[model samples]
Target chain A: MIDYDALLNTASTMGLRMLESGAEAYRVEDSLQRLCRAYGADSCEIFAIPSLLIVSLCDPEGHSHTRVRRLYRRGTNLWQVDQLNSLCRAVCQGTPPFPEVDGSLARLAEAKGYSPLLQLAGFAFVAAFFTLLFKGTAADALCSLVAGAVIFFAKYPMERHRANSFFVNGACSFLAALTAIAGVRLGVGQNLDKIIIGAFMGLVPGVAITNFMRDVLEGDLFAGITKLTESLLTATALALGAGIALSLLGGAA
Target chain B: MMEIFTGLLLPCFYAVMACVAFCLVLNHHGKLMVVSSLGGGVGWAACLLCAFTGSDIVQYFAGAVAVAAYAEVMARLMKAPATGFLVVGILPFVPGGGIYYTMEYCLSGDTELFLTTGIHTFGVAGAVAVGILLVSSITRLLREGRAPKNRHLGGEK
Candidate 1:
């Protein structure tokens, strides 16, 4: 018999890990998989709400890809006996441990999914784009890009989760953008064209744009809108950076 | 001439490294990295090939196709989602900078140049999309047709 309390706690830990990892959408699914295994429950499927509540409430301005799937076990699979109802009972009530269960459960948890790092990379790319547009100088744009890249690279050494890593990434972006602008104004030739081009070098809308169109084609208006909104916000941030920097300079002059 | 090559090389390298890093971070196996890199390389190579040949349309379509193929193959082998690989792998080939510049033109109040650049950007995006769709649809059709054979070969009950 599985200790229900212990199982839930473990599941919650897995959930926290996923959230910290910037898992976008697959976090809940992966967590549920772990929880089901721990409880010796047969098959379980996790349905993540399409609304950004899961990710945004935790870390606003963070981007996550969302996914939904159905999981089931075939014949002779240790956990296949209990379906959704039984699994719910196990989670809510104490279910006896099934000693016959395989060791795959622990293996699943240890499987590294660099969820948070990916999100940080995406954020840094967007920040770099914005810095270039706003600074309107090649040196400033390059500095911002380098700064963002360095912050992202630092994630390898820090070993922190997504939220903290992104906070660092955002700080680096702001600093890089500010520094670049200051440096350019000091004497460097302000090359607007190169700055704009370099900033956008990292902020390609490949995933969002493709997914938005795919969702629309698949007749998923809700999903499409969600993706579209996320993409627009990132783009707006890029535009805002450039617009603000230019306006500030104009005002000063 | 060398300036253009240098310009193209940096972006291509960045695109390939980003795709590989994404795969590695996802904890996908070494096989996935190899396949994705190969695909990305092929796509970028197509771009350079196009530049040499001076055929923009062919270059764009070929690059998109190569990437789509790479993504499909990797997804099937890794049993993971293909979206991330496809999106990041083909990013270098996209005309995002062109679109940004077009918008900039309009923002700076150069409407005529903005219109021209905007149209050109859209044209590039449309061509790329078509190439992607073509490759994806073909791969899907082939997979569907071979599903029974695959199942049989795998000895599925």
Candidate 2:
């Protein structure tokens, strides 16, 4: 007979470990695979909802790194599985996560047609286009571009450690705003609203809100509450950064 | 009208992008992607609707409800843990304004205003929590009432 209690305990422990180690959604997913193996389960899927705390951790130099790996059993062979990575970079600094796993997984997932560099370049370019379009000042645009580049470069790290989605977006927005503010101080465009709008582009919590509603409708109250809390917090973080900047600027006025 | 749409478009797109990012993070492609994208779309639409109506309370409630509904449905359909999806999907709809106001009031040395805003922030959070609880209780009752009967359901089949 299978030891259900032991399995449950192990799973719970793994979850707690991942949470404590600052593992984001992808890390949690990977951890779930490992947990399933420990219990001799054939297959498993895991998802960690974007929480405010998780989002806040997306600051480029906050907290330590955590790695989670998942193993899948195929007949007599145990194979490695690739988990999602979240990359959060500040301006031109920082590195991405999961280079090896990302490459391997892309190869396996797309056998004959895997091109990680191309995909990454495409994402970077798209992000840059949006940044330049919305940002009213060169400084703001440059900051956004740099942040996007950093995101591309550090994509593997961000994904591997499971940085918070909200945090990554919020940080990018904050940096953009900071750059715009600096531009204003340096006698650039005075379109505060445009800069504000541009900076806020990355701070929306659409996915979290949707998931919150879904969980509520599905009658999973605990999950719903947790998701709701997370959504609220990420929003708060964005607001906090903006509010602080505005307040300081106001004080000078 | 165009200005309003423009105002809404950037945020909506950003929200969608965030959702896609989350999907990538979770390695959810195929049907899961569709579900997540729909969830994101609904949430963004709610935000725009709230903005158009110019009602803060309405926006908050609408966003919360829409997101909660999206998450719950996906949770049931996917038969996976709902928390991950719920957390990620609702990222765009949080009440950032109230939080900013509260923090600003505090930093500006307006204790009364700060306290008031702080309380308001907590109230918003509480409201969201209550809504989640309400939905969850109803779901739990329905689940229990409709539980499948089986001999192998108990301790040792």
Candidate 3:
């Protein structure tokens, strides 16, 4: 006897995890439907947006079960998304037992990624090299490197508290701008524009913009629009923050 | 040779390094990280290679197309979703500085510069989107046409 409720729950959980880890809406919906079909559902209906997922399937006995999951936090952890994606494919292919599937999901949720130190190095590397790529002097890259570290340290704590993303982005850019300005004033960096741009690149909405286009092209207009608004708002927040810093310092370059 | 080295190879190197570091920030590891960062280099090179067009939008479009095609091929070979490669690979063309400058112009009351910069920024974004969409749609169509069968219709007991 197949447990319909558990099946719906498992499938919905998989979709929820994918969405929370920044999977595209259509991919989440497809994965949910596939998981259900793999578990003996005649057919399944799955609807997924950025923050919500709903999956419903009718058991062989004609009783329908539906599972709805609301995602509270969303971040780009491609590792998690990739792992969950592989897990979904494997389960669909082999029709794994329920316990094994549940165990894998639980383990993945607790999996650790890069260490904080390595991630900090990542932030610094991107900021420094991007400064160079944008024609900034070597000193400017060094300044942005420090500013990048500041943004990371400032943003990390807020992220842990689940603060509003807009506020976090704004604060990070504000801090980065101020740091860049100070670096220039102290003669440690040249070209304020280059340093500011490089420092804030870490906070830019590359993923959001990419997803906005992809979701739109994939016919998930609602999700696409949501991401477009998200990227736009993030850009606004960054500009507003940096503008405030520049105006306060009387250095509008 | 010096012009080619400075114009092409150096920038591509910077893009690839930045993308590799970015992969760390996104917590992507292993061979996928190395492969995806190469896509970034490919994108930047394509963008530079199209400089003769004298239009940023067309250059970005070409770069995005190259990245999307690279991502599709890598996704197939690696058995991973293309999103990983696509997202990381396209970063070099995302126009972060443009967004900053546009906002600065708007804030400083330079309405004319703001308008032009803002429009250009959106144009670059739209070009990239269209490029990715074209490649993805064509690939999907080709794959579906080739298969034309539902391989996982029912549960395997």
Model 1 agreement with the true structure over A1-253: per-residue lDDT tens digits: 4444444444443343333222323324433554455446433334332342221111123422222222221011101111221333344355344331212334443554456656456445543444433333445555545544544555345434434322333343333344445545665436544444444445445555555544443344555576657555544444444445544564113
Ranking by DockQ: 3, 1, 2
TM-score of chain A of each: 0.43, 0.42, 0.97
- Look at candidate 2 and tell me the lDDT of residue A157: 56
Q: How do the residues B1-157 of candidate 1 rate in per-residue lDDT, one tens digit apiece?
A: 8876555665465556545544443343455555665566668767666776676767777888778777878767765445545665666556655655665666677999988887876677667767776776676567666442212211131
Name model 2 segments beyond 4 Å from true.
A1-177, A183-253, B1-14, B22-30, B50-54, B105-120, B146-157
lDDT of 2 by residue, A196-248 (tens): 44444334453445445544554444555765676676676666665656665
User: What is the per-residue lDDT of model 3 for residues B1-157, given as tens digits with 9 covering 90 to 100?
Assistant: 9999998999899889989989988989899999999999999999999999999899999999999999999999999989999999988888888888898888789999999999999898889889998998888777865531333221230
Candidate 2, true inter-chain contacts retained? 0.15
iRMSD in angstroms, per model: 10.8, 9.6, 5.1
Candidate 2 clash figure, as a count = 51
Q: Write the per-residue lDDT of candidate 3 for residues A210-233, one digit (tens) a residue.
A: 888777766787888989999999
Best by lDDT: 3
Instruction: Please report how far candidate 2 places residue B117 from its true position, in Å.
Output: 4.6
